[model samples]
Target: MSHKDTIAAIATPPGNGGVGIVRISGGQLESVARGLLGRDLPQPRIAQYSSFIDAHNNTIDTGLALYFPAPHSFTGENILELQAHGGAVILGLLLERALQLGCRQARAGEFSERAFLNGKLDLVQAEAIADLISSSSARGARAAQRSLSGVFSARVNALVAEITSIRVFVEAAIDFPEEEIDFLADSDIQQRLQQVIDDIETLIVEAHQGRLLRDGIELAIVGRPNAGKSSLLNALAGDELAIVTDIPGTTRDVVRQQILIDGLPVFVADTAGLRESEDVIEAEGVRRALQIQEKADLVLLVLDASTETPENLPVIPDPKRTIIVWNKQDLVAGEMPLAITKGLDSVIISIHNTSGLDVLKQKIRQHAGLNEASEGVFSARARHLDALHRSEKLCRHGLAQLQDFSAPELLAEDLRQAQQVLAEITGQFSSDDLLGEIFSSFCIGK
Candidate 1:
């Protein structure tokens, strides 16, 4: 529970490999290292060939021992890393030996949590460390690295500095009520506020792209029975993940697939065909399909172009988030119907022939705002976006108060709230519960 507790864990992954690492961190690391190495702690930051010993002075393994002193280590504490033959049993014995030497087993993410608490890294950077380790693509890893290097934190800190300055000015003006200088009505202050708002808007857009790269997007494919929903899923996923048949309701459950588009993951769920059914199981599948459609970031309404015109369809998807996919276009007699395409984004595709699938994929990427150049994007999480949105809303509300009501006090309060909300992104303002929830997702030994 406390940073003073010397913690140790097997840093390497499970199973046998070429080498394994047992990491230790705490104020007591110096003596612990001496106990394990059977001699004085090695020169700081240098790897020394030594024998890892057990409690009875028996050599457990012969490998390299690396020591890092306090104030310059990853966790801002004395640290030791033991590199030995990478076998599950060997690593376990080494970790057990450290526990015998006054070190407790580290919980998941305890090391990075310590780094955050010790000021060596902020919450964003600490989270980025985990993100980097779990990244699925090179681009995602680069984005996480950008966040870890303080790119995102620097932008947030800049916003906080500006807001703090404005708050100080407004509070100062409120204190001097007798002054004729109308600071609240000053055009310069309003312009500065507006500029900050614009910057936040821009940051929000970039963070959204970063989030897509990190968490990806959920796409639900839904439509009436026998509309080639499973065919489209197979085409997109490049595998026969779902059964494609002429029979209606062939897919009685949702079939999920992970499709990568230029390093961005797309979790595509091919849900059961939506239609009225007498069978209880088929009806349940239809109900679950609707639920997935509602929750998905984008819904693909696959329509059978060969059967009927687009206007005659009984159900219409939410135009804002749904893409009308007119499938089986190869069977259509003439050019596609132009009606019912005015409001929503629709595409003509032949899943059987694999036509227009590229366009569909591009539309998906565009919907996620990831079709653009992603250079310099810093990875972001849902919480970061939520905080940014809340902060932006508060700033907008404060601007309204200043402009419409000329209420400096209300505007000042709004600014304070906005500042605090922004601070949460970097852990400047965070509760213990939030910290625990965030770090607990990280793998142990991080």
Candidate 2:
């Protein structure tokens, strides 16, 4: 818990700007400040415009220096901020001066890591800061903000408390043994377990939606050549990102466009026509299309309504996860066997006339399991999802042990393991390697 040494770095983004900031955090900030300012002016939270002199009392650069005392500042340690005119050289000079004063340069994400260590922010909040910074949509940003504000952590903590209460009762029954007979028969215990399961399921649904927001959905467009694949891509993206031509085999490679629909990031991949071909390039494209379909969250099956029915529509992976889009529907008069695979399958649309595109977009959102009308969702990484899944599985195992009236010790052991997995999600109990791996992903100076 006792972190040694001071870490310093230019906190602002790279490149020249009107102004830039260099930040330092740790124990030796006061001494480092005194050395650079040539005097002790550690007025916590007060800006002191001073010269950034070196150990030899030579001016490094003039800047406004501010200090934040421990337990109140970011990283939960003494922090120093040097705000200087935005110049790569000026910030570089300031950083060099700090390093000379025995302050090591800050590592990527170190500041957030320190915040986690000092209990200023939990693991979820720390990750949210990154998500907020890199959010692609307004909704995603808002979700990250809620997570950073501890909304997600609060919910997780409440669930953990609920689990703990159940665990305590189960363990107590094992120890007392006298109450064991009646305890196993109590319906209250079963009710509490069921309620907890319901809560976990709800969280899983919400978190999965949030995950889609963060990771976005991968959609692959497939059909025979001249099926209006490029046109559909251009229409959805609202730009001519992919080459659009009337030729049957115009697109020879997979063209990808990332666009936001209803504030959800969607990767629209326009692939070459899915069919046997003699051209080497077209063959490669076809192969790539199949591969993309395997991992795609949804497949936009574009069928040219102007032409004959597609004799061989590509076999979609996870049919439940696909939406068969009948494009160029305007060419045909009315619906003709529009069912792609039944009610759970497809939708008809006219990309040429821009008809039914709204319906198509809505369907995409639904396929992603996203509630587009959602007021808010907490951003969660795949790692958090993994942890939650493992915790849920173990909890269910514990529930089974209880229902069967098996050995109480078996139930207790499962609960203990489940608790540890949940604890890891919030950083309640963490390993050094995990800490290192998480923080190292951040850019220097956080």
List the candidate 2 regions with Cα displacement exceeding 4 Å.
Answer: 54-58, 179-181, 334-344
lDDT of each: 0.90, 0.83
What is candidate 2's lDDT per residue for 241-288, written digit by digit as tens? 889888888887889989998778999899888888989999998999
* TM-scores of all predicted structures: 0.96, 0.95
Model 1 TM-score? 0.96
Roughly what TM-score does model 2 have, to 2 decimal places?
Answer: 0.95
lDDT for 303 (candidate 2): 72
Backbone clash count, each prediction separately:
0, 1
Clashing pairs in 2: 108-443
